[model samples]
Target chain A: MSLFHWLRKKLLFLTRANLFIAIGFMLLLAGWQVLSFYTHEILLASPAQAACALWGIIGTSYFNENFLITLWRLFFGIVSGGLIGFVLGTAAGLNEDIKNILEPFRWIMLSIPPVVVVVLAMLWFGMGSKMVAFITSVLVAPIVYVNTVKGIEMVDEKLVEMARLYKFGFVMRIKDVYTPAIIGPLGAAMVLITCMGARVVILAELMGANDGIGYALGVTRSNLDVPQLFAWVLVTLGIVSVFEFILLRPVEKHFIRWKL
Target chain B: MSPVISFENVVKEYGGRKVISGLSFQIHSREVVGLLGQSGMGKTTILKIIAGLEMPSDGDIKVIAERVGYVFQEPRLLPWRTALENVMLPMIALGMNKKQAGEKANHFLGEMELSEFTHYYPSQLSGGMMQRVSLARAFATEPEVLLLDEPFSALDLQMKDAILSMIEERLLVQPMTVLYVSHSQEEVMRISNRIFMMSSGSKLDELPIQHCRAFRAGCKKAFLKWTKQIGSN
Candidate 1:
């Protein structure tokens, strides 16, 4: 295709909303690099040191296993929590009795601090990947549930009436009405669950995990390996972003084409 | 012959209020019946009950067929879908292939004089145009009974007249059992074969349009006399 056509297609995808996200990230990166210059060299590694050191340590054996472990934990945790929460959320939305039963639990989940799930999981499930995964799942469930339920509540009642009048079956109703409305928040929830899952994995490692990025960050902190610690943080965050772009973005784009 | 649709001893209650109590009506085959009523007198509710959108609370309702196309009080087009796509939604909902559905929808749009606006979204259309698109969608499905709830009540006089003329021409060639709900007396005389005037939960009068037109204000012997008679009934 010609460059003109390519540019036009690119422009079609352009929106102020997503463009602002890119701009904000760039600004934050720049500010962090500039701030490093005025700070203590040991405490705050210069951007050059952080970048170079991070690159050098990218494939190092010390960081590789832990990072991979945390990644796996996050993926599984998010999937489990998101599925359960989605089911619960939809059921509660459809049935008043379910809503009455689950509303209190949902509120409790929302109000409690993140650490509470983490602490409780550690205590009950015992320390390891399993425990960390459990904590992450618990942390993510409510956010996904609440957003999905809210999306369901916003479906057009009149459209539903039209569906009934036509004798549209369950599959047809879902495809025509519910899918368009539900997918929006459901897509957002997936993104959130993924990020939150990563956080919980790291936090769980710090709390009790023997292997994962969190454990490495924890070890490096105690040993005053600030540069290495910063590198690990950067690498983990990079991994998260890469997965979101590669995996989640395409899925979100497919489902959210209606909004466009 | 049994009526095409019948509402027998219909008692419609909404949260302890008796909206339509012990009401009964019958519409025969190929007849266009106008439901003339004030707002919130349960005309839309009756349409819904017949459409099976809502089941009656206490009534014996008989609909001859399952195919019902409903035009809601408002045009409820999918904002995300184009005119053709919105019209094709019923076909798609019925499990028709997208390719076939689109072809059928395009045909209907052309028939409705909306071929140029097939790709336009509902938000882009004027209120009258939206109603036309909604009408096209309902008719596209080839429904057995087309239930219209004040479909053209939002249009300006010129636009409304043009639409009604189109409807009249179309009905001459291809007629469905139509239950057109409206408050406009002119619309009833123009389109309806039969008229049922709803008043305070009972029919003020149910008569042929040929007779009812004379009883209306403009051409009547005495407008005040007819209005007083209607008011007392």
Candidate 2:
């Protein structure tokens, strides 16, 4: 395909949903511009000023150091939480007794506020990356567990019976049936948990951590640099979006190609 | 020759309702037995019992076969697996290596005239094509006993004839003891050496076919005559 045609095809694939997202983004920008006109620059940064701030920080050592640290924390938190959740949830799905035992813990984890969990982590682990990672994982794990359980439970019984009739061993049944059955919901859950994990890690950093994008945001807040804080937020969003589109989306699509 | 399958006064019940009571029958090796019944008349229950998917509530049921192939009413192809992969599944389970299973599956798909569509997923295939794949999967295992439960009921008349012919041709070359279940009298008469009628009251009536001018000629003539008499009346 020609470059123009390829680009056009990609654009068309976005559908009406993309158009709505674009409109929402434009409205937010217009509102920010209006607010900046009415308020002091220190109080409300104009979209242009925030963009300029973003450009200023793009190549700086400060930006690179904080961005990398935050990315690392986010990655570790998501991976650890996701793996634990998948294992536990699959066990629960396979056995009613396990599900019953885990029910109370799942509920407790889900019900507790993220702020309280962060506070407890701060008290327990002290102020550092460990604390931030703990808080993020704790907050995200329950959601992953819930989604995994739902996914596994929703697998068709007829398929299971078919597998049994064919004398499929446990591993074969898991590979051919269970994995495909859960991939769709699990993919959606991973996307959700990752996004939530990113946000929570930043919150944890703001509360206690010494380095990362949230720390940078705190620094900007202390200096009354509204434009720079907004710039940091935008950068963080860009990183998360890159992770989602570049890594998760393709993996999800590959695993669930049967649905497509 | 000894009987390959024997159901000796088998009794089955579910939730206080008797589905099959005092059922007794024997299927000899290399024999094709057709089971005719209306819906919910325990014909499928009998197949399931023989397939070891369900148990009899009382009495004895024995099947002396190394492998049993079952073609259910609906083609239960794994939606994710392609036609060839679905066909290879039972072979792989039966201890065939991947390469050997793939080759065998390919051969069967070829026999069913589904060679070109072997890579197609179940969702991509039509109903008739899916059922053909299901048949190929069953036959690929080289099962000692084949159990079919209305395998072609979902197809059009032409598709049904095509599938039936495929099955008949395969059976002729490699005869296996078969317990074929269907609602159609004509179908049962055409395909089976002996026929058994089942009813909701747990009664089974046997009709033995006598060879005349051709295969199933006696049963076919009787079926045609019966249909004609009903039409005339």
Per-candidate DockQ versus the true complex? 0.41, 0.55
Writing each residue's lDDT as its tens digit, candidate 2 over B1-233 gives 78999988888999989888888889999898988777887898899888888889998988998788899999989888999999998889888999999999999999999999999999999999999998898898888999999988888989988888898999999899999999877677667888777754356766534421243554456554543543354
lDDT of 2 at B43: 91
Q: For candidate 1, what is the TM-score?
A: 0.85
DockQ of 2: 0.55
Q: Quick one: best DockQ, which candidate?
A: 2
- TM-score for each predicted model, relative to the true structure: 0.85, 0.90
lDDT tens per residue, model 1, B1-233: 87889988888888989887877889988889988778988898888888886677787999996578888768888776789988888887777889998998998788778889999878788987888888788877888788888888777899889878877876777788999999887887678878877876645367544466665536655433554567687
Q: Give chain A TM for each model in order.
A: 0.87, 0.91
Instruction: Give each model's whole-structure lDDT.
Output: 0.81, 0.86
What are the per-residue Cα lDDT tens digits for candidate 1 across A91-150?
A: 877678998899999999889887888888889988898898888888889998898788
Best by TM-score: 2
- Candidate 2 residue pairs in clash (backbone atoms < 3 Å): none
**In model 1, which regions exceed 4 Å deviation?**
A1-39, A61-64, A111-113, A119-129, A243-260, B95-99, B117-120, B212-228
RMSD of each: 4.5, 3.8
